[model samples]
Target: MSFEKENIPSGVGGNMADVKKSGYLKKLKTMRKKFFVLRGESSTGPARLEYYDNEKKFRTGSLTKRTIYLRSCFNINRKSDGKNKCALALYTRDDCFAMVADDEETLSEWLQALLEQQQAGLDGAPVPAFGKCLSSQLSTYGKLWWKPKGLGSSKNLSGNYRLCLTSTTINLVKMNCENEDWEFSVSQITSNVGMCCMCNTCI
Candidate 1:
């Protein structure tokens, strides 16, 4: 329940070779589940909704298109109005959902509670968050980095970088260059300032 590192399925590695070979990648292609955690003022809940893919599940009629839903029922039990403090964390087939937390303790506590509830469930719970995150991250970044012939490739781009702008700056970013080639470079001072916006810590 703690999601030890060793418990993750084998084959995924630092390199992309395993991803192409493993069945996990294929499983993701057909995945239809939407899992998300809702962190609220005084309570938090984790929910999973699975929408049946018409192409994959081909039973006829309106009942065939129905979505299956499952959720763990629990409350965060926070004291005050903590919407500003509340954060949602989840994992999907594409990426790990991590809401920025004030500290590590909050993250660990939520994870522990979630795991305990999962273990107590009648049916086996979903995959561990860490494993799900890793698989999702790899699949996402792999797609971004993969280059197919003919198409201009994103392989040259680094996906980890951040881009942001304030309301006024956003307006400037949206302005037409009018055939002028514009360029901006970050200095050490600008880089430090950029970090605050990138992490959403200042906001």
Candidate 2:
């Protein structure tokens, strides 16, 4: 309910005040906004939610405005108690953005829609074609720049690798490899940060 400086970046821990407090609403002066939420089509490709600046721009069919990729979203929440119960917040890796609903009932509907969309992102997106792993469902896949510890400025030992994820093991394969020399396994890992591992280490 309290107004924040718009477009300000929040931490990874998320802006807790957006979820818990609305005490300073009366003292803060905020700008008026006219926004339209737009949804992307369902697909394995990158899922997204866009908000147009205004109604006329949206009706004119301009689809390239402010966009939030669901894959990067880490949290979603709606106000549990407040003078205005229509505030909903979306927290991504770097920002916390909020939207207001017409009423509490309308807020519930919007929350449900957002929950489903956010959940869909958790299932995975933009699956790559790994010729031999058809039986296993992909969680996420992307190229990673891997530089091993204890190696000081070693260009030969550090290079780009494709990290693939499935139901079980994380497969790290070199972009150009002829044998198993470049393929890495769990056994090779010595240690990792606990929180960085996430809820499930596997896909």
Candidate 3:
């Protein structure tokens, strides 16, 4: 990305390298301005609603956290009559902000932009990739079935079963059966001592 020295305000005086080191250049390159956006609303009414750009660089003010690194956001559903209005849930580590957009398309644009910024901010960080954080699962069909949670008796509980692992729980699906799939929380399960790292333990 090209950095414009003129774009930097007076107080933020320095060469491009200094600005980059301060992490201001990244924010400036991804700034987005939206119209009719409301900030901090409530059930009875909006607390402090206005069209504002948190990403904007000002000559005389401290930058808010949202302006620096907007991490993630989720969509809020409104009634059919509220079609033109779109609400979003914006979040940081210790803080969250609610925003309203004029329409779905506009909300989509902002969501994409903020997510891109979040990805960009973490591009060179020494953090694990998103895929590594997820748990691996295996599926197999065999004669080893079990009942779901809250079932006490294990008597005669063998049948065609399918086992799968998830990030949080283990799922046991009864093949060709109408019963609900059994789910075991990963915490409730234990692994044997000296287990191989290559094989994932099931609950």
Off by over 4 Å in 2: 1-31, 41-45, 63-65, 80-83, 125-203
The segments of candidate 3 whose C-alpha lies over 4 angstroms from its true place after superposition are 1-68, 71-85, 128-203
RMSD of 2: 13.9
Task: Give the worst 10-residue stretch by lDDT in candidate 2.
Answer: 20-29
Kindly report which residue pairs in candidate 3 clash with one another. Answer: none
- After superposition, the stretches of candidate 1 with alpha carbons farther than 4 Å from their true spots are 1-88, 118-122, 125-143, 149-203
Sorting all predicted structures by TM-score, with the top scorer first, yields 2, 3, 1
Q: Write the per-residue lDDT of candidate 2 for residues 141-178, one digit (tens) a residue.
A: 44555554333133243455444544554554444542
| Angstrom error at residue 35, model 1 | 18
Error of 2 at 76 (Å): 1.1
- How do all models score by TM-score? 0.23, 0.42, 0.32
Backbone collision tally, model 3: 0
- Give lDDT per model, in order: 0.25, 0.43, 0.33
Residue 56 of model 3 has an lDDT of 40
Per-residue C-alpha lDDT of model 3 across residues 1-203, encoded as one tens digit per residue: 11101121213421122121121111112233432222222232211112223324332332323232222111112212242245543322222244555557756665555444434444564322112211132222122434322232342334444444456655554444434346666765555222122223232
- lDDT pick, better of 1 and 3: 3
TM-score comparison, 1 vs 2, better candidate: 2
The better-scoring model by lDDT among 1 and 2 is: 2
